[model samples]
Target: MTHTPLLKPVWLSMTLLLVWLLSACQRETDLVEPTTNTTVSNTAENETINKWILENMRDYYYWNDKIPASPDLTLAPSDFFDSLLYTYSATAAPDGDRFSWIEENADDLSASLSGESTTTGLEFMLYLRSQGSTDVIAQVLYVLPNSPAARAGFKRGDIISKVNGQPITTTNYASLLYSGATNYSFGLAEVQNSALVDTDKTLSVTATVFQANPVFLDSIYTAGTKTVGYLVYNQFVPAPNNSSGTEYDDQVDAIFSNFKARGVNELILDLRYNPGGYTSSSANLASLIGKNISTSSVYFREEWNSTLTPYIKQEYGDEFFVQRFLNKSQNIGGNLQRVFVLTTDGTASSSELIINGLRPYMTVTTIGTTTYGKNVGSITIVDDSGKIKWGMQPIVFKSFNSQGQSDYSAGFAPSIEVQEPLVLKPLGDITEPLLNEALYQITGNRLARRAVATGHSLPALGSSIQRKAGGGRMIKSLTAFKTAKLPQ
Candidate 1:
């Protein structure tokens, strides 16, 4: 009993220790039994954040108010949003719980649809430049070669007035041209006779749309003593339907076969503004001209964050090149060599693919200014809602060249960069200086002689289309090389 009696100092110390122990025990108890409502609120907060993200994407393009976009999105939608213009920006989500819907399928939704938007007009149409001459039109793209329109004798510079049973008025022309008539084939319409009885008169006529062989023909030039061939490939896009009617690929194959047969000393394939088409077609052309070819382990491919919501990877393929490409893989090939390409800012997509594919094997000499750098692409898919969603905000996966360098964004620089020559041509005539330069390199009586004297053959280009000792008369057009300027 006496020992149990504690001093006042000891009692105080013991009391403090007990109080500290009690406080520690209380902390543990609280930790073991979290309030159910508190946990639920936390989960709700996370869901709210995700909801905010989805809302943001859905409402990014609303006019009056910023449509509330969803917030639970991964990094892709945001990146996609920044890349598009106001006219093309899109944010779509399901009517209910938009967050979960997008979270589950946003990646694909952003990429699959084509023509997300048009800035200046409602649809896509070719814009032409008037090259000053009353007879020549400028800024016109060659949609088909030897087609009814071209063969019906519609020259490159001919101004089209109307299509089948319609006046080529501005109100309907854009839409009409984009929605061209298969009936016209390759033909173009012009303003018919101005009769007092008929106020607006335009008539549709058949043009030449025929089976033309791809031949360099004897259009080669010889300056001092060299032989040079000049050929034009206006477009490379395949037809929607045809054995070879509108397919750029068949044209390419024909061109290569002609090239192989023609025993060319030197050649010029005029692609000046050949707005690129066909992925495999371009590759085929490159391989034909290329000496060493290597297949890519990966092409332009992209990978999205898998953990965030419902993320999916983008697979860029021959088809997706028209869309923005995502991730791509390549296979090694048997050949590798040099390639000579003439290009411009108009050279895009599948056109660039040719350059990229040929870089590893051939001595790539780009003869134009910097190309349009649109590396990323997307895919289109109809979701469970049956709504056509351009899902898979496809990203640039891999631009692995044979050399193991991916400078796709920079585009291939011209070894001999030249620009459009300031020539005195009418509105529709193009100013092609690069093509002439390539000709200058291969042709010229003096050049042919020099090559021969230098112990090189005058390009016994394999076929019978080789130029004779002296070539044809020089054509007086502004396809000159010396007059062009180079871009910085």
Candidate 2:
């Protein structure tokens, strides 16, 4: 009918439509016939990345010999990398070889190693109203300075009853709190008459990127003639971008300096909530506490995989095997005979390192529940080429303290077993159960106990809450290496 009409406007439109169809066909053809050079380049680049990963794993992985001889390289990088891990048998222990992991972004991993992250600036412990109860309650454990939670006027011991206007239950608690939300609405609660009661007050907080200072709380407590330095040392991370320098060292020095000035004799390191950090920072903190220990003394030793052990021994010598205590100017040199370490399941890695490393030099009395058992450490490995952003945090070595003790795979049992109570108190508060026990151990004075709701144990909290927060302390080595220039 259109052809019969033969209108000038219709004829022109038909011609234009034909031309447009031809152009679209040509474009599709061009896309299908990609250049050989580009195809070859992509394949070559992927091969290069795969090769780099394999080589690094062979060199640095704790179980280098256990890696598959011929990995399926055609698989995705993350999958291929995981396939090489030492597979655990059904009969073997659960945590046989689960520490090694890979990160897509190396820069972010590096930043995290230095204790920098986007956070709400809040660290809280989730607890059931009672054992076996689905009704969950969160007690603010500590707040990082300059964090959104702190800005929102959140203080430790503030109970969180509801999240996003919904009552916090075991089912939705993890998703509500740690789902990486940019904003959060927290409904406050308080324990009245030994029961959790909802309050009218609510606070909204937005997460922001901030550098967390590892030194959470520090105070010099005086009980009679005993001057005790109590430090809530959260992590072993050094100051941001100043890991090589004394930026973090200076902070520790300042605290100890104040302690020294005040003639603080006894030391109580509270690693109750500390998940580990930099190994070097751990060594530094240990050196400051055990100032009388010789700088030449081996604080800790690293045991690499059998493949690289011989080469490392040859290149770096025996001294390289062990990390020695540094004789820094800031070392307080208090020469305390015994030190009390406040611990929980959260106390792990470098926190445990400080405890284990200092044991040969001093009496480390561990209080609270068992310490997180991680004697192994990891090194950050990044792609040599700027093309790939992938990073690998492979377990490189098993660390042994001065006495060659790395046997804490099942966690270090507390000398004085005490569980964190359901009713919480502010950090450094003598009335807090953990701190109270520590002080009682120190001064032999039983401070009046704060009334707590009975039937709360760490195992219940560990099961309900810790499982949601990605359970246990993930300790990363302060050490970093490039893919191209890995140590022998």
Candidate 3:
């Protein structure tokens, strides 16, 4: 079955529901009692919002039939919303609904979707020096450009031993690292005599509103006769304000354009720390890398619920269900046959979508660890009233590649499996283990390996650590609407 478009029939479904609810309210006049205008207005508004939520769920939710037919409308919106999730069975193990969430402010939610957030702009990995030990050390992953952390001279591979003069332990790391503090003092350290020794150097950083640019790092490398292009894309966010003409996407296009001019024959896409974003951006990236693929060929497919399936089929036709590769002037449709993808647990959603979507057209070799398996996408819904800005992001559809494969909930395994090295190496450095592995595969020549200094080795951090630090596979959502609207 073909999948639905990211541009869903949300307004159409919402309008039909509102019309039905207005008719029902007229018929059930007895239920609403005569009261003060203020009280009556509040009650009516709540009823309208509740009715709209239910109707949208019925029409667009992936498990629409599982929603109860007679849920209490007077309950708090959050509680009422939870009661509608598909919980499977009481005896079954809990696979919590981690995706669906309601935002109190639609504007804030919209900003977050556009990759704007307040932070010190630091992405790091935490590791325990010994198994089950409290001595936890953090290795800097990558710092966002123009961020507070970046201004403080923090870079990839910097070891952080202490925060605010307190040593980092498993018990207190959460409070010290992720307690949403505005200002923090970090102590630099190095391995000395088999122990983490503070170098007496301290740097303080203040968290501020930082616009996270998804295109973190992009460069072209010369490996003998092969010109390799490497891009460290952190998210799949499109241009801000939902503007057309590829404002954000043009950043990528410009990079590929340089690669095309440079006669680049190989591509290395680094999504190691990406947690997914807009689906349209993913499709665009796939198109740029898939040089030989035809624009008319299907990139991915979507599946919707049964009740609205035929209606969508009749309304938008078969083409609406399948996203095809876009033909663009900047696309690097070069002499390449295979692409290399660098992934970790943080690689998810549209990241996985790009990996899966490109497989049918080219040879994709994934390095590093397995991916975060998320074959589903969501749409954001807000109430009709401009007063209440509450927005709902619910998983509405599951996506599949052209080959009809979407069973990768467990994640995609790496073709060349290698864990990120505990001994820090600067990103984009040829000596970096993951990048070195990719170069080895591309050039058929092994690069010289550097010996790790004794006492620098640390225990492998569990996936749970990544999850606790908000570094694993993420819930990907689609916000493709040209403008916010109410169901008229």
Candidate 4:
């Protein structure tokens, strides 16, 4: 007997459901009732000494995915804390290169992963950069091509050996990577490994440091007859911890209200590579484009009760609630007419939830290649054995349009496909001619054949054509809700 995958034929609704507890919060749950030792006062709070694993480790088994055999773990709670969370150990083990220094009260304090976190690249620094730091970026993960770093020829594993002639080492990532003068001219070396490389093994490059927060509305798109509402949404950092973040409750209000005020009809949501920040952030965005928009249903959620028998997950579901960041009045298609999004493979997690959720209500169109097909979300576990593991699982809960379309694996099929063009003359500079294509189609204005960029297949100027869309995954429709779309 074979199996299948579950997908949501994306309607641009928010698919994110709040679940996993942050490492600190999880530690609070696992703590033991303190003893009555007279030495320590009652008010003295227990200290949790554990390396914070940024991602969830244990997860559900999709039929298709190979289920790793569960390991036997037996250790006292305190010992479990030390062994599992490397940061909690007397001496932390090196994670790749340098992990951040862990402190008990440092939930609000964190740095970029030695290399960029795969799920969160530079976008993670929006807050860190705002607060200001004197650290160097020793390594970066490549989430998108033609990005500031990728266009600069920065690959996933490239290590930073020097910044502006200053040598970078593991112990000093914060100094060389984070600390820098704004718009300061700096030369950097890309090393194959952390080992100080000779000139031959490294590539020298330069970058300007700006505050991490990306400003939206920098440019209003009123390119004649194009009824477009342009909103710049990048990255999803949870509230409070990240300074670059606007309050999850009020951010969406401003974005949509501005679009309505601008007399804009169509929407252009730029999420080129928004590594998911907060599930709350995603829910807020989804409420904007959602059609009927139910408030009291499972959006998406998870559970882990390894302590009890079954020793696994007790249950999971997708639950929904009204997000704080919403307009008091329902404005489905008044000032706002339709949606057009810019996406890339680097667009993942909450980004996927947003695109996947808003599918039905708006005439949503995506301009880019395929999205990062991450139907599954993650949950982390620091077991009693002192072994830290990130547990990942796709939630059983989902959202569907009035038409009952929930195709998780297939993702959102773009009405139009556009590719970013890279050129050599400028070296790392990129031009988004695809944006022009999307703008043209939405405005009812056909471009001249010569006006269209050459290469790749899509509806060209003067060509009325039907094309093949890239997204086709196994989605979980409402009827087949109970384990029908389970991954095989």
Any runs in candidate 1 off by more than 4 Å, and if so which? 1-138, 141-143, 146-153, 158-251, 265-267, 294-338, 380-398, 408-413, 421-432, 444-488
Poorest stretch of ten by lDDT in candidate 2 = 11-20
- Candidate 1 has its poorest 10 consecutive residues by lDDT at 11-20
**Model 3 lDDT on a 0 to 1 scale:** 0.67
Per-residue lDDT value at 52 in model 1 = 37
Give the per-residue Cα lDDT of candidate 3 at 160. 85
TM-score of 1: 0.44
TM-score, every prediction:
0.44, 0.82, 0.81, 0.48
lDDT of 3 at 102: 50
> Candidate 2 lDDT (Cα, whole model)?
0.67
User: If ranked by TM-score, best first, what sequence of candidates would result?
Assistant: 2, 3, 4, 1
Model 1 agreement with the true structure over 262-342: per-residue lDDT tens digits = 443454555544433333344445545554323432222222122211211122223322212212112112221233467
Please report, in order, the local distance difference test score of every candidate based on alpha carbons. 0.31, 0.67, 0.67, 0.36
Q: Write the per-residue lDDT of candidate 2 for residues 1-488, one digit (tens) a residue.
A: 11111111100000000000111111110111223454555556555656767877777678888888988665456666767777435477354454555555666656655667677887777678666788887888778877888889999878888988999897887578756678889999987887779999999998887788778889988878888888988666667743556587678878887888888888888988766766667777888888577778888888878776766556556776678998865555554778899988777677788878888887889988887677776666665445667666666778888888988866789998888766667889887887777788778783335323232552234322132111222343323211122343
Instruction: Rate residue 188 of model 4 by lDDT.
Output: 38
> Tens digit of lDDT per residue, candidate 4, span 385-464?
33222211123223333344445443455556665432101211113454566566665544212125533221211100
TM match of model 3 to true structure: 0.81
| Candidate number with the higher lDDT (1 or 4) | 4
